[model samples]
Target: AEVCYVGVTSSAPSSVARTPEQFTQKLDAFAQKRADVHGQPVSTHTIVSPDPIADLDDDLIKAIKEVGADLVVMPTHPPKNLDVIMPSHGGKVATHTNVSVFLVRPRDG
Candidate 1:
């Protein structure tokens, strides 16, 4: 089974969680919402970053490496001009990491 780490980042000086139970409760709520939307059980390992708000691409790559993820799925907005579309953080991650990335661009409504 693949381990999913739900990362939570905070920039505050106090990095330690106030209460482990409270932290777990919030994470559990998020997991439940995800499961409800997907209509399937979701297993997640939670992570609270000590040093927060680093480069998003670097953070994602670091997280991927930590979990040894074989694949990554990221969502992007549909671009009007495919040729001129700017590279997103997801794109950077794919470029830098050996792991495969599957980018999903939802159809523009």
Candidate 2:
């Protein structure tokens, strides 16, 4: 079945405490739940990788293709300002990957 892949890049050492398999499973469960609610079929794969800011686009594309992902969904942190051209890992991935990508903006409080 075609699956969705979520790539999470973090610089925090503590974030690496969880195994990749564990993280993937959790994401799968969450996706399953949402799919179930919507009466749709969906599968998820999660990749936890260290930040590759210099070549983040390459890293994300590699991960997405490795999982045979049909689509990618990512969340962005709040932007500091309108003029600020904040570097985005998601943006990089979107620009580089061949597959479709969806960037979900964070809710403003």
Candidate 3:
């Protein structure tokens, strides 16, 4: 079983708009789904940082390393014009971190 650390960066306004509990629940559900599919127990640590793209890559890197993550997974919303390209921050973290990164595209209805 591998432990997972889910990091989310939100601006002040966004944070104010959403509750941490709500965010954590969503992440927990995600982790649980992965665990179910893998048939392995997985634990998750949800973090609400101010903004990894703006203020906290070093800290994020350290935390991810400390948690012994096998990979970092993030949701990316690419611009409509460049939907084929991954988000910039996804590239930045993938380039900067030692761990592998998986960028999941947002689901469309």
Candidate 4:
């Protein structure tokens, strides 16, 4: 499977502890580890945006297309009541993208 790992960083100062470079390095390391485990080639990409979570549908879609991914596997949590009022980023991506998307909720350790 063609795998593309994407990371987003914000320019504005906030409580985020990770720097943009650190975030990119983390993304690269994660992709490398996945590739090693799956024995498949992987690519890493980072997007610098003002809002990391919001307004990322377009960028995410573009990255998906650029990677020519057949399926998108995204980590997402169960929806809350507030999710009805404002959809999550994964929800927006599913709505906008044409490819198949699989949302995985992390398991408790």
Winner by lDDT: 4
TM-score of each: 0.60, 0.61, 0.56, 0.79
lDDT of each: 0.66, 0.65, 0.68, 0.79
Candidate 2 local lDDT, 1-109, one digit each (tens): 4445454544444464356666666677878887777777776645455764555566668878777777777777766574257557777777777778788887778
lDDT per residue, candidate 1, 1-109, as tens digits?
3436455444343344465445656677877787777777655544455554555667788778877788887777665465367567677888999999888998857
The best-first sequence of candidates by TM-score reads 4, 2, 1, 3
Candidate 4 wrong stretches, greater than 4 Å = 12-19
Taking the tens digit of each residue's C-alpha lDDT, what string does model 4 give over 1-109? Answer: 6688876677654454357777777788899999999999899888778886674777788788777878888888887899999887788888888888889998877
The residue-level lDDT of candidate 4 at 100 comes to: 89
Model 2 per-residue lDDT at 15: 63
Which prediction has more favorable TM-score, 1 or 4? 4
29 Cα displacement, candidate 1 (Å): 2.9
Q: Between 1 and 4, whose lDDT is larger?
A: 4
lDDT ranking, best first:
4, 3, 1, 2
Clashes per candidate, residues 3 or more apart or on different chains: 0, 0, 0, 0
